[model samples]
Target: MTLMTFVYLIAGLILLVAGAEVLVRGAAKLAAQFGIPPLIIGLTVVAFGTSAPETAVSVQAALDGKGDLAIGNVVGSNIANVLFILGLTALIAPLIVSRQLIRLDVPIMIGASLLTMGLAWDGSLSKLDGAVLFGGILTYTAFLIVSSRKDKAAAEDDEFTKELGLDETPKPYGWVINAALVLGGLVLLVAGSNFLVEGAVNLARALGLSELVIGLTVVAIGTSLPELATSVMAAIRGERDIAVGNIVGSNIFNLLCVLGLASLVSPLPIQIAANALAFDFPVMIAVAVACLPIFFSGFRINRWEGLLFVVYYVAYTVYLVLFSTGKPVAEVFAAAMLGYVLPLTAVTLVVVAGRAWHKHGFTGDELKR
Candidate 1:
């Protein structure tokens, strides 16, 4: 909390946000110019671009031998993506959930989250685990590209088309300009991430906070700012597909690309924190699973649901604070959540999922019959 620490933290945050905006702008523009469809860009370029800040920060943390920070960042960002980012965005506007997301991406997200937790069970992420995770992303990306081309018309109908599409007048920028933008954005990301991580580590030591705590709270929030900005703007603009899809895709990439690559680059296995294993990882997976019922019920997230998400996030953060500080109220909070809140919530989600499944059995034609 020294002046220099605060200065670096704020400056780094500004740079991360600016860098991600530039990177996404250049990459989105270039992708559009290449005739890549909008849905694909939403799922790939925009999502990954927004997540670049997390990638840069986590990878550098791993290289610097701050494995706790690297792992915490990935885990915390995933949690924040669903609970915090999506919740906030949906509060601004109800998000239209794509059928493909419910059918394909949500399952993949859940599976990836579980796999990450499983790999870390031994208290570390090995290079082999990193390879497997990164490989999944490459394969998934290839499949998305091929499918988008085959179904170009459907892809074009996506909400991102209107958002990321070139101007109606279509003034084309040269390849050089696009490349420079991308390069400049990358430079900014690296420098900003360095400052941010350095400041965070220093602040943690000064405050007697563990690296993992700062990583989960401070670093995770800072790195995820780009996602918040992109998603909230998309939601407000009524580009709901990009808003929801951006969160889902960024969560996926944070695990597959950010954590995976970071573990690979690190000299030693990335140690997993005990608290993360006992509670946080399960919560992350549960949050991923929660989307299934919510998205399936109506193919849209309603205002009430958004509010519920926000409340849950706040509760989770409060629990983290209590547990981290070893406050006397920690046990009471944990008991209440485990004994009452979680069970009720689980029952509610199951009921909704069942209703959705039953209703879905009869399409308009079948219902008429």
Candidate 2:
């Protein structure tokens, strides 16, 4: 890669972070002004705002005929949101699970993950599939708005309230300034995505790496920085719900909104490397499914769980690098993860779930998750 490419990549990442922050602040302020519930705003507006980078990158890649990269970004981002972002945030502070997440949002997330797997199994997500996924987001957002209004009369939750970004000591800004922030953020996101994708694709070609690999490793992580920042800050501030919710919400949006829009731009054919099909895509689904057990275990993600998450993510990334480079150790890494780590994790989750069941004694959480 050229020095200029590195500069472009760094600049793109900086723009993504700054743009997401500005967009979120402006959108959250607008939501608060209109008296929207914190949970709804966090789940819908802030969630989509933070996910804007992924949306831009994926759609841009798709338009540029790099559908594999676009699809990889969606899948990889979802996995990272769960195992990397949420895990790290929980380590910062044990994320307090809202019963609502267990009862409602997580199930939706799992369903979405499963749907993605099914749709992509045919080696593509067509425009019809995109339409269906995009439609689901619209319906889900509407449902959230209607239900959340009834639940939270005036933005009650402390965590989501803080996500509103505008303090109680509100100094009113004119509508034009807020709108300008939103528009400028969008422009930056688009420009940043163009630069990032260009740098990544060029670097991939120069290094003899496939577009899918670049998308999964570099582009995916780069776009996910917003989620990382939001969740880390939320955890630090004890905005526990938003910390967890941001990740979950972003995962949903990555699949439904980001991929949906990208696929509509072009048929996002899953013409990817075999490793992605065999390992990464399935791993993404597995991670999504894993959330149900972990969250329900004690209705919280503990430090140990977070540590395991980080370890698994590290192992995944390392395996990808080794496998892509045709290293001898790649087989061993895959075996260890598939033969030992996965089985042990499953057994442990069963134990924890059973223990939780006995302790909590079969509330509706089981039925819901």
lDDT of 1: 0.83
TM-score of 2: 0.90
Model 1: per-residue lDDT, tens digit, 1-369?
Answer: 689999888888888888887887777767777876667777677767888889999998999999888987888888888888898888899888876787778999999999898888999898999998899889888887787667664646455766665443445555567678888898999989899999999888887777887888788888998888888998887788878878888888898888889989989888888888998889899999999888876677877888889889889888877777778998999999989998998889789867876877435222221
Off by over 4 Å in 1: 28-43, 153-173, 362-369
In every candidate, how many clashes are there? 0, 0
Q: Which ten residues in a row have the lowest lDDT in candidate 1?
A: 360-369
lDDT value for candidate 2?
A: 0.81
Q: What TM-score, computed on C-alpha atoms, does each candidate reach?
A: 0.90, 0.90
Each model's C-alpha lDDT? 0.83, 0.81
Candidate 1, number of clashes: 0
